[model samples]
Target chain A: MSWVVENLDLIGRLTVEHLRQSALPIVLGLLLSIPAGWFAFRFRLTRGVVLTAVGLLYTIPSLALFALLPPLLGISFLSEVNLIVALTIYAVAIMTRFVADALSSVEPSVRQAADAVGYGTWRRFWQVDLPLAGPVVLAGLRVTAVSTISLCTVGILIGIDNLGYLFTNGYQRQIIPEILAGVVAVVVIALLVDWLLVLAGRALMPWTRKGA
Target chain B: MDLFADAIAWIFSPEAQSGSLPLSEAIWTHLAFTFVSVLIAAAVAVPAGWLVGHTGRGREAAVALSGAARAVPSFGLVLLLVLVFGVTHKVGASTTAFVLLAIPPILAGAYSGVEAVERRVVDGARAVGMTSRQVLGKVEIPLGLPLLIGGLRSATLQVVATVTLAGYVGSWGLGFYIVQGIQIRDFAQILGAALVIVVLAVVLDLLFALLERAVVPHGVAARRSAD
Candidate 1:
């Protein structure tokens, strides 16, 4: 506990940087995945190809991607920008499939009812499809957020230090308190991010609630 | 494009193909970690999972545990274990991390697979005076084999990906090539290592799919696909 107090200033900065790196990819992922997901759903050929490609992307280990991305993107290996690009690919890959699945999970009967009422594609998507997909999409976002926070720490090995610096340094110096602080801080961040997403989901889609 | 060609050349090069720490050795180390961790995970999860599914209890707890397990950053877990156990026990730390990563899928798969068996089938077995143990062995497990295999497939892939991180913690599997390549600015070696890992994953996935088909009761397999 005293260790935390002694290092409070360092912790404060790293925590902010950790959240910044993670948040950027998620926001970019959302922008990319929504339109791409919808396009895949709209086209039959893409349905199989896109989902399978994304699954293959997931199979590539995070460290492998961390190594592979720099040259592929023409960025320096140690640059945080390379880390961000890799993470964004991961975020988009995961979120895209979730976007498609969540949208498709809306009942066919409910969609048919909307169509019968003379609703056009644009308004009906907003009123019916997006709202119905809200819960599942939110759930995917929560997973993406937590996993990204954990994964972005891999950047430390490639020389782009974030919160993962704690783990690497603690291990090198054989410092128990710092290691404990690092592990506990990561768990806390994951929980806080998850909770914020849950709250955001509830706020956006009040229709998902049940009255008691 | 040249790096891709070089990676291909690197993979086939004599230095990588055969030496004290050859390509085969690294591949073996990787498979060893995966094989041991997964086998141990199955031994622990399968019986526990079967009992939980049989009683229809602890399913929620199982799901919650798996979710928490997944959220734990596996590389950090490796470091923690190494810190507690010391660097000399890198194998233990890496193996333990792989086991933790492997358990969720197997547990979830086994439980869901057993639960997925139709109640009528089990009841019919019971009506024939088969004991609960016999019913599980004969009816539920066979029916559940499909999902059990599915769980193993997922568990294997996760463990395979994670074993790469084992090298970071000092266990030097195929990930050695990637990490060392990065430090030395050897792009081909990094790509070579990545290519090997990807091929390893694809082969295992294909093997699991074949195993699932072979084990699943034919009619049940058909019904599942129909769904």
Candidate 2:
């Protein structure tokens, strides 16, 4: 449409900023989740409580979280910072569940073999558990990445400028062309990011290519 | 109960009936806005999804489209709509945006449901001389029913939560409480709004669970056991 062609560069810039803000929560969530996941598996009693808490975290509505942030932190991008924190809470909550599920899926024999070789708990985890669980963790990462991207769109509600701004503006004005442009740009970007993650997953764990 | 008392107190407070406090008119309007839009979305999304699933062409493309739909973000969509529609009414913008929010899950569910059915079952039905339409209606649909319901459940919860974003455009929902709460630093109102959302989610989820149980074909569970 004419709207898309006219605003191509503007759309491009909004998409990039959107990606940048979204990346923070995803990267942080993944980093925090991996360790917490490992810790959860190591500590049985705590695992249930942690996973339940994380599950609850996933249910918090995005707009409510955004509004709650401004009072606690003065009205600014710091509110955006809280939004990121809230997203990480949701991501990590879901990630931990996936991580635990993946870990559980590892072959019992392989774990036993690691123990038989006198590998310390940490060493065995790195040598065996992590590699075996890599595919599932990667799948979880993919979900978290996409979910974070989606949630970050809600960031616009709090005055953060992102790709969502374009679409929201277009929709508000009833300019179908601009709204279509925004939708196209977002869909293209999301697919690209998702495919890149899948590629990374395949490259990191070639064994996953074998059908389960 | 204390909770009831608090709710009544919150409802009766000068703040509740005053300016910008969304009361019955607002609640009914929001419910209509949300339920109607979601119904519209389902009407469009469900059959299209079934067709996509049945056809099985462009599976990856369809999935990608759903993901993109999910990523579009409601608030920004409404703001954009306000400019184009030439109307400042928040309800119109919110409804348009919520439709976008509601469609993807249902589409994904229906598509995946159709794909997930066992190939041999399709073949078996055909062997019995069932017409293609009959096979799809009797065999494939029943089998895929559970996943379709799952998708609806997820979609419904998503719409319920995202509908609040319409508040930014001036439509009143529980989100009204959240927005007003923040404007006046009313923590109880904020908490009440949150509690309402959580309760809605749980109740809706439970309702979907019952719907799924009621609707999933008996043969599908039997198939699972046989497998």
Candidate 3:
């Protein structure tokens, strides 16, 4: 408890860094994945190939991806760019699949209805399909949020600062209180972000609240 | 060419491939961690899922919890456990984190599986005066088996990734090779070890795919695609 108080400022800064690492990738992933997912949907031949590649990418351990990215991308191993780039790739990998799944889940009748109303392709997508895809896409975004936050902490192992640093620092010094604080701090950040996403999801899709 | 040659050389090296703690040992250790934690998680998660699905209780909370569980950084959790307990039970302590990671997916899969079972089937069983146990065993279990196993598939993937992370806590696994390679700047070992993890995860998912098929009853298997 005392440790948490003394190091409160450091923990706060780390959490903010963690949020930046997570938030930027999720935003980037959302932007890229929408188009990528639509391309996969529109081009059936590419669907199997694209999804398989994404699955393979996701299967590679986060640690390995971090270790490999610097060499592959010709960046400094210790640079923050390596961590962000690897995490962004991860964000893209899962979000693309989620986008595909969300779009696929939209019923054929909904598409037919849009056509019946004389909705054009792009306009129909934004007005009809995109809105309908909200619940699922939001769910995926929530997952992306949670995962990126967790993965951010992994950077500490490779030498970046985040709440994960608390664990490493505490472990090195055998300070149980600081280690406990790190665990609590990380979980609190995770839950806090999760609730915020939930609120955003509900606000965007007021339809979901109809039942409630 | 060096990476290729080094990879090839490392793959065929007898010492690296066979020892008390060789590549095979590392793979085995990784599998052991994944399997043990998953087995324990299933025991805990499946029952909780069953109760929730059966009674329509706590479903919302379960979903929330699973999301929270996913958000807990496996890497940090393992390190904290080791810090608190030292390395006396590295495998056991690491398993705690893996178990936490495994439970949520399995729970969700199972709950959804049970929840997905057409209510009429359950209603019919109840109308016939069957015990709740009978309905669950004869109807729910068979029908929900696919998703329950699907949960296991999700859990297995998580555990595989997590067991690799667990290596940082002195738990022996394929991750040790990756960690050692990272420490020594041995790219070949890192590549080889990373390859093992990827292959293992893919193979396990494929195996679960088959198991998902075989575990369903013939009647449900026919309707599987329809569902």
Top candidate, metric DockQ: 3
Give the whole-model CA lDDT for all candidates, comma-separated.
Answer: 0.83, 0.73, 0.81
Question: Evaluated with lDDT, which candidate comes out highest?
Answer: 1
lDDT of 2 by residue, A1-212 (tens): 88788888888898889888888888888888888787677678878777756755565577666644544455442256766777877789878888888888889999999899898988988889999999889888887887777667776655677877765676556677876676566656766787899999888888889877
Candidate 2 DockQ score? 0.33
The CAPRI category of model 1 is medium
Write down the RMSD of all candidates, one decimal each.
2.5, 4.8, 2.5
Show the lowest summed lDDT stretch of 10 residues, model 2 chain A.
A69-78
Kindly indicate the candidate among 2 and 3 with the higher DockQ.
3
Candidate 1 at B152: error in angstroms? 2.0
Provide the lDDT at A112 for model 2: 94
**Residue-level error in angstroms, candidate 2, position B147:** 1.0
Off by over 4 Å in 3: A40-44, A68-72, A75-78, A202-212, B1-4, B18-20, B224-227
TM-score of each: 0.91, 0.78, 0.91
- Total clashing pairs for each candidate: 0, 24, 0
Residue B144 shift from truth in candidate 1, angstroms:
3.0
Span of ten consecutive residues with least summed lDDT in model 2 chain B = B1-10
Residue by residue across A114-134, what tens digits does model 1's lDDT show?
A: 999999999998899888988
